[model samples]
Target: METDAPGEPGPTAERDATIEIDVLVVPDCPNRQLAEERLRQALDETGLRAARLTTRTVTDGTTAARTGFTGSPTILINGRDPFAEPGAVPSLTCRMYRTQDGLDGAPAAARIREALRAAAAAGGGA
Candidate 1:
């Protein structure tokens, strides 16, 4: 990884890497928009403009299970749920994120930014 200030361009190697981010939410989930906004912010802050983002609406339990839908507003980076805890079961309920301030409906920008960086370091967030 190359060293560059926030909002600046990173190394060509990172730019060439492919990153896929998915925001999965159930119908009537209140935090969906907020989560998407925070995710976009994280991507921008981490200088990952090349990332592809997808928003999915999981409406059924079976679909949730097959898609790894842990909860509404769940974020998956490269098909891996970075925020998922071990032994977490798939559900259609609204998810709570552990933010720096406290537990909230969505993950904090800082947390998402860190996750993005960690994924990049791991070679294209795979």
Candidate 2:
């Protein structure tokens, strides 16, 4: 029998090596820096320090729709939007996230970490 130790990566952990992280934002997104910082911290916490990180600029509505960008400062893990709500529509606008305190421009660090872990467990990096 095999067991997964607490806080340790499981079988799919190997996929994390190929994880693709993208931060999408408009030209002048106010939360771009915040989002990037939080994502970096989350990656470190999740032991994905070497994950590939990319930043994309969505300059127009067409680009946003084509790329499935929900809004500026959108973070995609393995090309999936972990925080996306059902029926979310792509837009060229600033995005907001629900946090413990209230609405915020960027997702909390804890939330980003959780999303990364979930993506890793699901072998989404492939």
Candidate 3:
């Protein structure tokens, strides 16, 4: 029987420390590219260089439901939806974000950065 040494984390603990970020989008979503770029900038700004960022394509309602994808360009941090609002529905349409500048196809850079920071703090991995 092998046990983790004192003051050393086990494999599962170390794996749980990783932050998983997913940008879910549809094939025809125009804002997908911008979302990806913004997410990258946010990751860099938040100093989460080791975080894993993945772009997943959600083609059908079933996939969306399974992926917890609210809509195209939806971002999931650590397997949780940060921008989820009450009454929001999961679909394959392009998602709209309410920014300081009004409605937009994607969330602002500051918002993405804030989400990353919040997720990191909650995960205690920052």
Q: Write the per-residue lDDT of candidate 2 for residues 16-79, one digit (tens) a residue.
A: 5668998999998999999999999998787777678999999988878877899888998888
Reference-based lDDT, each prediction: 0.84, 0.83, 0.78
Q: Candidate 2, clashing residue pairs?
A: none
TM-score for each candidate, following the candidate numbering:
0.85, 0.84, 0.81
TM-score of model 2 (CA atoms)? 0.84
lDDT of 1 by residue, 12-124 (tens): 44542567898999997999999999998988788786788999899999989987888889999888888887888999998898877888988899888888887887787
Error of 1 at 78 (Å): 0.1
Model 3 Cα lDDT, one tens digit per residue, 25-126: 999789988888888888667666567888888989998988778888898888888888788877888889989999888889998888877776566342
Q: Rank the candidates by lDDT, best first.
A: 1, 2, 3
Q: What lDDT would candidate 1 get against the real structure?
A: 0.84
